[model samples]
Target: MSRKLLKLKGAFDLRPWYQRNDYLGWIMRAKRDATKVRRLQQMLDELRAGDAYMNMAWRPRR
Candidate 1:
């Protein structure tokens, strides 16, 4: 897998990027598990709501 880097401000922990990613990956594996659907959506929402630092973190370096 390609490395995913996350740039966090001094206010944030470095763990969330990996934790959230791992959780999302786990959710994908349970394609037919209805119990996790809501959780998956919640996580997706978190990712979408990420701040400016996160947005820049994922962008390709110029």
Candidate 2:
């Protein structure tokens, strides 16, 4: 009976494994999107500065 109790205790004492790769994957995707947004903003700023009418050109003409 004591052996069975020891086995149970050993099972209960086991710690949960940490998921470092899952967290690292999320961080990498976030960094990628942030870089993409910065590049897009820079392009928009350049377009606006180069020509004021360029903003209107982006609108759909009907």
- Candidate with top lDDT is 1
User: Model 2 over residues 1-62: C-alpha lDDT tens digits?
Assistant: 68755664443233122322432343455557886566445434533343222133332223
Q: Model 1: residues >4 Å from true position, as ranges?
A: 1-17, 21-32, 51-62
User: In model 2, which runs have C-alpha deviations exceeding 4 angstroms?
Assistant: 1-31, 51-62
Window of ten residues with lowest summed lDDT in model 1: 2-11
Tens-place lDDT digits, model 1, residues 17-59: 6665676576777757684786566554444545423224442
Clashing pairs in model 2, backbone N/Cα/C closer than 3 A: none
TM-score of each: 0.35, 0.32
Q: What is the lDDT of residue 8 in candidate 1?
A: 23
